[model samples]
Target: MSKHWKKLPWIIAGILVLIGLLNPPLLPWILLILVSAAYWFLPRRGLIGPVTLPADDAFLPSQQVQWWYWTGHLFTDDGRRFGFEVVFFSFDAFVIMRDQLVQAAITDVNGQRFEFEEFLRLHLPKRVKDGFDLSSGAGNQVTAVGGDGHDRLHAQIGNYTLDLKLDSTQQPALHYGGDAHPYRFGGYTYYYSRPKMATTGTLTIDGQTFQVTGNSWFDRQYGELFQAIRQGWQWFAIELEDNRQIMLFDFKGNDSSVEKSGSITDANGLTTTLAAHEFEVTVTGEWTSPNTGCTYPSGWEIVVKGEKFTVEPLVKDQELRANHDLWIGPVYWEGACGVGGAVAGQAYVELNGYCKCLAAKLP
Candidate 1:
């Protein structure tokens, strides 16, 4: 047995003796040890038998890819707005490891991008005690609150001199794995978010200054297993004209099966979940990337059950393929979407990892 396992008996015996001396509960302590030993050494009755059912091979891969991610949009009292996106990607194999990237940009109606980048390094805290209450309701759940009375975050890239605060008033609704059926891909993820936030700050990019004012969106997702060869995904978070919010993600598989995914959060904080079969998202336009020699779906026609919407590209050639070998880097799309039965609002779309070389596809 390992050193830790060999010491277990001695440690338990010592604890029993100490407790017996402190109080006249020696009989109870002795009985506890007997029961613990039976559970530890017994075969079928042991505590390590199995808690969860052994997942099939198809499900095991996703179980291994787990991480924590959170992204939120903040809106200030004035017209100024900021967006906060944070993620902690984790893995088990040496080839796979925990990777984190955060991106924050300020854009105005004038088409200026003031951005800041930071890489997360520290571990998330374990518990919160004393004077601490988790900020919940709307869809926001407090995952970790440091003892120092503030959430901790690290910056990896971009501007070095930047400071910001977390606003609890704008917390979104809380939807846990229990609230909805677990999203099954390769593994499972406990995803949640604090959708809208208000950020007040000035970001200067490349010696240019732009004042930012708008609403932001935050998303948090952590799981062990994720698909590697999936063609691409298109995600949309739109704040509609009637103050309702909608989020849509469409994942395309290699077999040409489009997994239409999305969620609708009403103003009353209730969520109407949408699955792949329940929605229709189609690419209406295409942009070929000269850098990667791949074609991307630049425009889209999105029609949810009982609702119709369209997405048009703001910048069709917004591909970062040269820097990153992925086609879903960054682009802008602005279009109007009709929600529910009547209200129509302007929407934005973000597409990532949409292109793979023809050679990459050929055997």
Candidate 2:
């Protein structure tokens, strides 16, 4: 794509915003047209450059949005288990400025406790070379930085402090078939996941610390995400006992239709894309958050490749209510679950756009 052609969308958006500001009565109509156009055009595959690992894993400020996410299950020497999530997000507010936000959470399965914290900051000169170096909160309370699948993660919230090192064991599973053209639910994104990562870390709470070993999942996605988030999504990453990893996505459009897609990685690091009819998920129960009053689906019965599995949350109240302060804050459920029935494994599920309180305010 030429430089001028690449700038067309933002130029058109700026014009639309100006027109909306000049004519107050047309703002809603303008937004409706923008959304409609996005839905109609974005799903078609886009052409792009080769996507290489360890380098493309770095921050791409050129894109409008990007995020590095990690979710894992850890255990103590005895038997206690825990789930942890740490994500760093970067959203382009302008051509030269970006909004950086970090969210960290820990679910103490044995203790039946969930604790999380959020931090938001602004950075100028949208540029990050080589790899990602992200931190949030005062004195860097949360930090995650690495290249490829070898990474370090740290977070401190409430009485829990987690530090872990992750080493990749398998190749990344590229979603939407391949990197040549990757688009899902009306948006273009270079999405891939490192599903098998050997994790070693320490969890310190109160005054004691325990050495932990487990597995972690790494996801890196960037590109057109503004339209995708408006449509809600339920994402799952499951690591089975037989060394197979599956990543499933159920995206709901603005018109209330559901689109499903996924990728499965075998023990030998081979990944294949799944068609819509190859997988299905049914909600078995619901849980209402006391803090946000959002009713989220609790238990799920997932059928993949004709095999049935039941997934139940380790902690029901894993909702994270964002403390809004100049960034888009939406309450979301990112939690750990155990898989049974046809498979015995661990999974992480993320549910977004469930709470009307903050979701309705998103752009």
Candidate 3:
């Protein structure tokens, strides 16, 4: 039990003793009310516990914050290419209500266009044993019903419909936090990733269907992280041609300090944690969003283990501007990118906290 919890029982005991001395007849009723309240308020064992290797894939609704994220690069048979992103988020607000959100986007690389959609609702669909089936509106859904490596994703926005199946090609990469203890950025975070997944499916644009195949990255994180995301973060998931997959995170605190952490998984499913000194990242360019007036890093030159990679967004403007009624216009950048230099590959980068307005709205 936490230090706060350790003292709670003592305080409650004192209250009961005082009530018994003052009014013996009412003590039993008061004790019954307290017991009932504890049963309803406290989280159960499995819902809040230490994260182990091969972390559980089920949705943790009791957690303060959690998300399932996917990003990939797809190719068409006729020489066209595209990039896609789909993410589901679940969070509890002030211990009062639960909120669910889904965000989907597609980058038409050949068409030089980027389109996205999002929906926020009060409740989420029930999840089954270690799996989830979530849908917000018509033609937007993400389901992984079997808890197996095979998963299906479907989303449609504008004139594009992205329907893909992802199968894990390697074992799950348990992050350093999961290797031993949970990561502590804003709070205790249990994080894991399925770095390399074989992707195959169809993408429809303007009623023209095309068969596509590619690779994808899956990320799952849940914790008491309500304050962690508000500060800022730069996350990258890269898959190189040599079958080496990497996941990197740079979390920015309120005092302008950056904490760096990463993990590299080889072709044989062996993962090695990367310390802060093992890698470096430099900003190569910047782009200002015309819609939200937020200036974001446009390009990056990241180096790890003496190997350098240049990453730039497939399209210059892949920013998502969210204007939901429940939120105060949170704006951020998450997009598909191309990698070059020591080894060629594809990547997805997420940049958050670029807009100061979000912080200003927070109490």
Writing each residue's lDDT as its tens digit, candidate 2 over 252-341 gives: 655545577788999899999988899998989999987767799999999998999999999999998777656446788999999998
Global lDDT scores for all candidate models:
0.43, 0.83, 0.78
In model 2, the worst 10-residue window by lDDT is 122-131
Question: What does each candidate score in C-alpha RMSD?
Answer: 12.4, 7.5, 7.1
- Candidates 1 and 3 compared by TM-score, better number: 3
Across 80-154, the per-residue lDDT of candidate 1 in tens digits comes to 443434333333342234332223322232233333332332222112233122221222212222212123332
Q: For model 3, what is the C-alpha lDDT against the true structure?
A: 0.78
Error of 1 at 129 (Å): 8.9
The TM-score ranking, best first, is 3, 2, 1
The best candidate by TM-score is: 3
Comparison by lDDT, 2 against 3, better one: 2
Candidate 3 versus truth, CA RMSD in Å, comes to 7.1
Q: Which stretches of candidate 3 lie over 4 Å from their true place?
A: 1-55, 137-146, 177-185, 253-257, 358-363
Give, for candidate 3, the lowest lDDT window spanning 10 residues: 139-148
